[model samples]
Target: MDDPVTFARKLRREQTLPERRFWGLVRPWREAGLHWRRQAPIGPYVVDFVCKARNLIVEIDGDTHYSEAGLAHDESRTAYLAERGHRVLRFTNSEVTQGGEGVYTVLMGVLGEPGAER
Candidate 1:
């Protein structure tokens, strides 16, 4: 397994556009009550986004994720998180970046604040 520190450092240096956009848009909600950690280490897997408060992990998948191998890997990762009592929410990169408002709405729904606009 890779070192947690190293993994976090690498993630910090290589954040994708969707990751950055999501982070920026979610900052306010995080400040309000939801605490989130980017590239969080959970056992051997490093989640893209994790909200410890809600025990939820949000993953933004790029085009590569549509591949069979990527789907298998994601399934395994999701199972691990599920076993540990964490809910995983996946979003495509296009959905997050291109559909910013829609993405925020979905996230707000998941957060149990349906009417609250971010």
Candidate 2:
């Protein structure tokens, strides 16, 4: 009976290793003046990270996400967010763990310059 709010809180506390790793890199973006939220609830799902200002949601997927069910759910989630005018960025756990600079570059490209607010 864990509600979304409580579940999101638990997720924030128990973030996966990749989530933590990526957060370390992305969190510093705030210092550059870009806003992002971790373990944020959008509609029904609690996305791993989101920049509402940019209408972006970043999800770090673990092994479970490769399953058929997980893939279907993610597709639905992405479709829903897209319907709401939000863009979704999905990264596998290893991608964040290994592709540090690459991933950051991609994010920066999508996010634009730090202080360059839209």
Candidate 3:
């Protein structure tokens, strides 16, 4: 964790279940020219997924994110990203695991594709 490069590399190698699932869902989008990078380092943080072209960062929050300290940290991190003009989208682990279709639909909507009714 001392080195940001090393930390990002480790995160990519040890992706959580939700992270793995999310990546699987979006990997093919690269062919459509929606390039995304997993465990991308932006500033001092390593975002779960980032599409620089769209200025979008998607984060999959786990249990710890609900705690007071974690929430505070996330708030600041989000503010920092916003200051840099990046829009952040956060999804819980449960949301991705149990409602994957819904998550995919939301992402499609954010990506500006048609037919994302909800």
Candidate 4:
């Protein structure tokens, strides 16, 4: 990808099955004012999802992401984003495809209603 914005757009267009599933679950919450952007760019990386208001970035890790090099890269990326005061959340592809219950639980735990059940 030439630029982060362009890359993000491409990611949005070419979403994986897990990505599509996760997005479908969250889109309605976004419409209700918990704003979110799919395939958003922050600095040099393109995150799977971002909530600017919350300074949160969410990434969906596929099998390749478990490789040594990928793990190192993800660590650096997380550190870089953290340096800029952003929180990163990661979910595995299977976790998403399997129903995204854990993903939702974490998200809500981080950004849910004040009195909502955990």
Who wins the TM-score comparison?
A: 2
Going through the candidates in order, what is the number of backbone clashes in each?
0, 0, 0, 0
TM-scores of the models, in the order given: 0.89, 0.92, 0.91, 0.90
Model 2 C-alpha lDDT per residue in residues 4-114, reported as the tens digit of each score: 789889999998889889988787678877778889887788889988888999999888999999999999999999999999999889889996787898888997766
Q: In candidate 3, which residue ranges exceed 4 Å CA deviation?
A: 114-118
Cα displacement (Å) at residue 101, model 1: 1.7
lDDT values for all models: 0.85, 0.87, 0.87, 0.85
Off by over 4 Å in 2: none
Q: Give candidate 1's TM-score.
A: 0.89
Reference-based lDDT, residue 6, model 4 = 87
State the local distance difference test value for candidate 1.
0.85
In terms of lDDT, the poorest run of 10 residues in model 1 is 109-118
Could you give candidate 3's per-residue lDDT for residues 16-49 as a string of tens digits? 9999889877755666667799999899998999
Per-residue lDDT tens digits for candidate 4, residues 3-108, read 9988888888899999888887676567667778898888888889888878988899998899999999999999999999999999999999998888888877
- Superposition TM-score, candidate 3 onto the true structure: 0.91
Which runs in model 1 stand beyond 4 Å of their true positions?
A: 114-118
State in Å the error of residue 52, model 3. Answer: 0.3
Give candidate 2's root-mean-square deviation (CA, Å). 1.4
Candidate 2 whole-model C-alpha lDDT, 0 to 1: 0.87
lDDT of 1 by residue, 4-105 (tens): 868877997899999999998788777777678899888888889998877889999998888999999999989999999999999999888995888788
